[model samples]
Target: MSEATASPGLPSRLLADPEMVSACAARDFAQIFQLAKRRGGFHPSRIARACELTPSRVGEVMRGKPKITTMDVIERIADGLRIPGHMLGLADRSWERPAVPEQRQPTAVARPVQEDRPVAAGASGDLDEILAVAAGTRVTPTMLRSLQASIEDYWRHDDEHGGEALRPAVIGQLKYVKGILRDTADPAFRHSLHGIAAELARLTGWTYFDARQHSAARGYFTESLRLAREIDDRPFIANVLACLSLQATYQDKAEDAVTLARAAQDSARLDGGTPRLLAMLYMREAFGHASAHDQAATYEAIGEAQHHFGRIAPSDDDPAWLQYFDHTKLTVDTGIALGQLGDATAAEPLIAEALRAEPTANLRGRAFHTFWLARTQLQGLKVELACTTAGQALDLAAIVESPRVVAHLREFRRSLKPYRHTPAAMELVSRITELGS
Candidate 1:
């Protein structure tokens, strides 16, 4: 019921109005414009300022000359006007909250971690104070590139250290980028910003996914997808879809996972995405098929995945996001898909090779892959070896606070129920229990 104090976001009363809610739900911007004008003293110029629309565009919308269909613009309006995300089918905007007092502003602000150095973490009241003091500056290409580099750093840190600690920074940066997007007027600059925003959302969602927070993950993935569509970026769209598909697989929504993965494939194929990108999508599809218990379809998808991967050359212009999907990743994924089909004997060697080559920095990935390897080993009746492998996985998982990793380790422990009396099983169980406690 609180209004956005620093932002021009809607007041509780107007946002609560049935008619305003109806307009937002329908995405009827013209009606929204009229209502803001009538109820909130948001005249055409104010609406233009609040929503990041040109005055002419605002006029057109007011006259109902053009219906607003662009997702990015709609999102800007929603944030600027302070409409809650539920009505507009979005994740809650960073600005959607009660007004904070000036005395409390400094404490509420938290900046995104943009460099290698550690910084304090909090919300945008911090940004507002900074932007207010540095208002005349425009976003530079250098600035955008810097932000992108930070994203790559985040990915590296996340891979090695897990996502739990990075979650706050990731979300804070996402909110920051979105704030930058509002003030940036140049189309070229906005386009790049939108890409950053999309990637950031995906990363934030990924952090949530790592924590086994599927609902939060889905929301940010959806946000990323919408932002990608805003710029008609097919590769990014496919990436977000693939993220959703993988989340669905983890959530046990097998059929839905397949549907989402196929949709990602369609998007990836549209622009003739890089071999690596297509390969990753196919792997996701394979995961979905395997989860669905469709052995033949799973193998077919894995074949396609490898086919595309084989085509990847050094000169292939792959997106930065797909850089993590190298040969080791492909091998492990293939193993996992095979394991899903209950082919543990065949899956074992493949996973072992990949685990040996897995980068030391990729602790989380290594832990996850090791879990699958242990699963395969257990299925093949190598109980002692499985226990050893599971111990390694548990140690790695313990190093990084990943709920998904812990959950898998817990599941593996439960699987060891039959052999709980064995020395290897007893040792592993004791270690896991100590860690859990």
Candidate 2:
């Protein structure tokens, strides 16, 4: 198409404006979109269409959902908006040439993403949690079940995406559960509500741990333990202990982690531990051992974990929460423990196998397993492969809002210091730095 026939672009004056310049340099698309609207009389829809992005996506960018970072996306924006390559920190785009105007491919307008709480498919999505919370409506068994289902969804999303986004919702649910627990007169209601409260408190605590808010996490975890103890829920007590163990391991309190894991195992044993439960407990212990750099203890705990895991049959009556700790969990966990113990040679294949079994929905889990895989590869001196793997992990981690992933990526970055000059490592280092900034 001739220049005259082409859609008119943003005015050069707008692009040259200091605000525009700063927003571009900072890659603050939110400010950029708002500036375009306020100063250039451009609507988000037009910007989305011009950029081959959905109007909803443009809205999300304006709302600051996720940053536009991938090179392809940045380049596309450069071409679509007629923004100079240098403005986006890229080499000159072909479309910048006078003789080579860019071809703007059309993108289907995406429906705006909804933020409704998760409900089971085909079930009546009739539970108005927001309504109940506001109106102080009497809770029912059905509502409890609904909350349980939603809690499962919370865990699922927490695994897939990071927990930061879900924190508010979970805490709201926790408050609701606890409030109901306080006022309940019926034994059955009290029992059920107590269990739910314990679960919610523990879930909130896990989210705090993921955010690296250790103090907040421990407080919630202690609350969970207290609630479980109130009802003599041995299994739940064990579960909370396992959670605390993992948190302790992350905090570098390896001895405490090991002791907590042992206590969890003891509690599970008192409750006639399911094979899967024992397996998970042992895996927690393995993590503790690995963190302490106790190679012998680490392998022993890993062996025990795998041994128990192998005994788990399809018919076993494990706790609902233990359902998440399946074969895939054990595989990835074993590999991580091994890697942490400096036996990366034996860890890489296991992590890879676990990744293959993982559903794409679990983005954070994939990021985590991929990180271990990359670390193992690096340990084996496969620097380029490690860099590529780490890059993939970071890409998966980027959209997820977990500082835990960021911390892990930082450690990975430090590990790559020796190979910092290599192209792959340099690219990864740059990518990691960009993510931080």
Candidate 3:
């Protein structure tokens, strides 16, 4: 097998040692650090920072006084140290293989995206040459355009098949694009790269949310916001904030949802997004208010959304990302808000209309909207209709791979207890049981 390259100042023998490479790949930091300090002239403090650990902690691990736990910390250390993910028993490193064959770098060097320093703990020789060689593999606008296309393609797949099926691949793509961003130099290109990175992060967050991985989703959303701020991309920031708020709404954190939605709307107003984008934020605010049981505020926000949406025109400057927010989407969101606020009468027709117009390509969305429509049916005491509508959602759920959809179906099953004597309800219950949680 070909040996991995050694960090500057580290002995070639260490990198070549099978045992040492195995320790690093296994994330046995204690063993790796012990060997580094004794045989590689490595500095603990520098390694500590690279791993995002305190020097004392690094020492404790080296001395076997403490064990490094937490997959997050381990992954960070492996990434910061430029340990190939495949070596660490994870996916291939973003640099080891390009996301697309055309974007591959010419050099073998794989640098960390965040830190500019070399991977060596204390190496100090000709760092500029390494960076220059790495930078020579420039990411042009055409390359970024391909990346954007890939992201859109993933979105389509996520819409059809749900996030669980695509999370690993989408995240891998994000990592690869992020690596490219690190090597980019042109100011305009870097700014564009940041925009794409922010969107990728946001998409990753959405996928995590769909998978019911709330903590992971929140982390990615926060990262997206930070990347958006780096480029001062207000529209992207607003969209990310709206996504956070939507997650909060789904989790029943009404106050947090309202606060985040308000922030998103404020961001859009201050930073100048299109009317359609502003409308989408307003609709998000409506959902937050509905979740809070604030009927007055919910309708008011819904009205605002309608007002803003009415201002849209064919000549509007909406980006391609805003294409998902058309009239049908507005109707679906409004119906959801109304349903949440205990207005089944008003919500049912609107939701049904949107569901009817929903294309077959958007299976995940159709499942989601169907759930709301069933909820509205249940609210109206139409148990038979509700059971049938929910059955439709359950059928879709069986095909799509979203934890959120499963969660909704589970909740729907629980709601059927009141109508257990009804044959339709019992039939639906049997189907749900067969589907499994």
Candidate 4:
């Protein structure tokens, strides 16, 4: 028998190997495709068509081309093939392929040995040691305050400096703070750590969201919420809930988005009100309504969000995590809601202002705004501009290793099919389509 026909069947092997079985049962398309292709006999062309992929893509995958197949694409392919979705490795809807572990490089600082002794209760013992360690590592109150100020500055002027430029420093400080928190044993110290973790998670989520790695972003947001809950930090919990609501909206889970947003609002209400959190929750609710095509509800929510946001006082003691909320952020979200509501005309000015207000360094936000602009332009039949904007978004997306950004690009490619005959549009679409290979 020829090698292709002689190979073991996926079903038999799936029953034997736990990993393969688990992967199959989870509807993990990447693993299923890998195993199926290895077994051979099945024609690549047929598989490609079944998966809604181009014939060329089948050849690339069969030939082991250097391409990244997104989990969503794999799920779509599995759906198309009428495979038992659970067998394809989608058991955990939140399952994500872990990022490739980075090689550990030697650090400039000396590493400390892990201690087994439990920290003594109170401000003495381990707490004192932890504080001393933090001080040695320059993680003092002054340092944290300064870092916080820098982060705020970065957010405020991200349009000018570009988001990438601030990432290294922000991540560095976050890592440093995380280490300090993890090594501490005092209840008060742990509480402070929880606050820091929540904030870091938010930043990480934003970074991942910008990169278009929705799954990873969701994971970070989930962790952030967990941290806030551990600390009983009501405002932070509401903020994290708002983040989750946005994720649900983006993934087309409109009802879930609304539910989460309302929950966030209620949580904030119980905490005596946080205008920023309330505004974010209302804005997300508006987006959810827009996604559901409930125009009246969408408009009502948007008005509520705007009124609350306007009521935020400069003198009010807002939580550190809500520092990013501003008029510019509101405009961007409003534009997105308007676009979803099918009011492209109304969305245009707000999107434009958002783009103009966004810092050049905020590459991720720029990419997002540009992508939405492309969507709006495409809906309006401005094919050339849409193509150009999508191309720009693709360029920015490439610089960040984000799955969420990739997903957006994938959707944008789908929306560009009507203009595939146009060279510029087709070229842009081709690049994004190539990702699934």
lDDT of 4 at 258: 95
Candidate 4: give its CA RMSD in angstroms.
Answer: 26.1
Q: Record all residue pairs in model 1 with backbone atoms less than 3 Å apart, i.e. clashing.
A: 9-82, 10-81, 10-82, 109-123, 110-122, 110-123
Per-residue lDDT of candidate 4, residues 1-437 (tens digit):
64334432234544456665665565444455565665533455546544545556556554445232334345545444444445654542222335588998889999677699775658677787787765765333344445555656755544443444556665676677777776665443355556766777777776666555689779878888887888667777888888888888877899999999999898888766667778888998998999999999999999999999988764344654566678888999999999998798889779988888876777767887888988888878889988988899888877654456677888888887777899988799788877645
Return whichever of 1 and 4 wins on lDDT.
1
Candidates 2 and 3 compared by lDDT, better number: 2
Error of 2 at 365 (Å): 0.4
lDDT of 2 by residue, 1-437 (tens): 44335555677999999989999898777888888778776688767655655677678778876566534345546666777878878887665657756797676886676688674445334445555557664765357657878889999889888888998999999998887777666554576678788999999999999999999999999999998888778878999999999999999999999999999999988867878899999999999999999999999999999899889764454556778898899999999999998888899999999999998888888888899999999999999999999999999988778898989999999999999999999999999998888
- What's model 1's overall lDDT? 0.84
Off by over 4 Å in 4: 1-188, 204-219, 431-437
TM-score of each: 0.70, 0.69, 0.69, 0.59
Please write out the lDDT profile of model 1 over residues 92-122, one tens digit for every residue.
Answer: 7665556586564455668665988654435
lDDT for model 3, on a 0 to 1 scale? 0.81
Ranking of predictions according to TM-score: 1, 3, 2, 4
Give every collision pair in model 3: none
Better of 2 and 4 by lDDT: 2
lDDT of 3 by residue, 352-411 (tens): 999989898899999999999999999999999999999999989988888898889889
Off by over 4 Å in 1: 1-137
Q: Each prediction's Cα RMSD?
A: 16.5, 24.5, 20.2, 26.1
